[model samples]
Target: MKEFIDYLLKFGDLNEQQISCITANAVETELRKDAYFAEAGKVVRQTGFMTEGILRNYYYNSKGEEITKYFVEENNVVICKASFDNEIPATSYLQAVTDCRLIIFPKKNWEEISGTVMIWDSLMQKIISRALVRKVERISPLVSQDATTRYLEFLEHYPGLANRVPLSYIASYLGITQQSLSRIRKNIR
Candidate 1:
């Protein structure tokens, strides 16, 4: 919860009372490897602050290939905005890449918290906006850069994640085959 509170601090200060109010609604949740936080065809019912492990946001193509769009590491928030906002089925899946700990707030408590903690909505807006900007920045490079350049950028950007995540998932994230990623790694070494 400290990680979540610290993340919220980026928006503004929170008094002890406000913190208590917010914390009162938080619930700890866990996901084992490959567990889905938000599955495709299910509506998002909670917003989670990831305290440990990693999550991959992915979708399946018509050919049934998994296309990894992004990775959410520890100390980040996880939410399926489209499904949460529209109250419709999710198009993407948020799956745990490793055992995970998350501080979650159910949608049922949203009205109570958002109404009481005036800054909560604003804080979320900023976080989501920043994420979208980063998404755009990442997408541009994927389209313009070569696979090697993209893989190098990934290594630079994500640091230890290359070692932590499975090679196949990393390859999917790079929009390349596992064989190509292996060859790149060999050549680079």
Candidate 2:
């Protein structure tokens, strides 16, 4: 909860009372590895602040293969913005890549806090803007880089994430086969 508060503080100011109300409305939850935090075709009913571990946003391709879109590591917000804001079924799945701890607020509580707190909406806007920029920066290289360069950039950008997540997931994110990723890894070593 403290970590979550600290993250929020980076985006905007909040008084003790406001902080208290925000914390009171949130619940701490654990998601086991391989569990789905939010699933495709289901409304995203909660927003979470990740305190530990990683979650991957993915979707099934036309061939029914899972294509990893991105990863949300500890100290990040976990929510499908379009689904959560529009109250519609998600187009992707948010799955725990490892056992995770998160501070979560149900949609109702989130809206209530926004309504009651004057700065809440603006703070959220700032956070969302930062997230969108980071997403674009992270994704841009994948479009032009080759497999090995993409893998290297992934290592440089995420820093230690290569070893933390499954290679299959990393491969999926890089648009390559697991075998190819393995070969790249071996050759790099």
Candidate number achieving the greatest lDDT relative to the actual structure: 2
Reference-based lDDT, each prediction? 0.90, 0.94
- Model 2 residue 153 CA deviation in Å: 1.0
Error of 2 at 141 (Å): 0.5
Q: Which segments of model 1 are wrong by more than 4 Å?
A: none
RMSD of each: 1.0, 0.8
lDDT of 1 at 77: 82
lDDT, candidate 1, 62-147, per-residue tens: 99999999999988889898888779999999999999999998997766789899888888899899889977877778888988
- Clashing residue pairs in candidate 1 are none
lDDT computed for candidate 2: 0.94
Going through the candidates in the order shown, the clash numbers are 0, 0
Predicted candidate 2 versus true structure: per-residue lDDT over 1-189, tens digit per residue: 999999999998999989988988999999999999899999999999999999999999999999999999999999898899999999999999999999999999999899888999999999989999999998999999999999999998788899899999999999999999999999999
- Error at 55, model 1, angstroms: 0.4
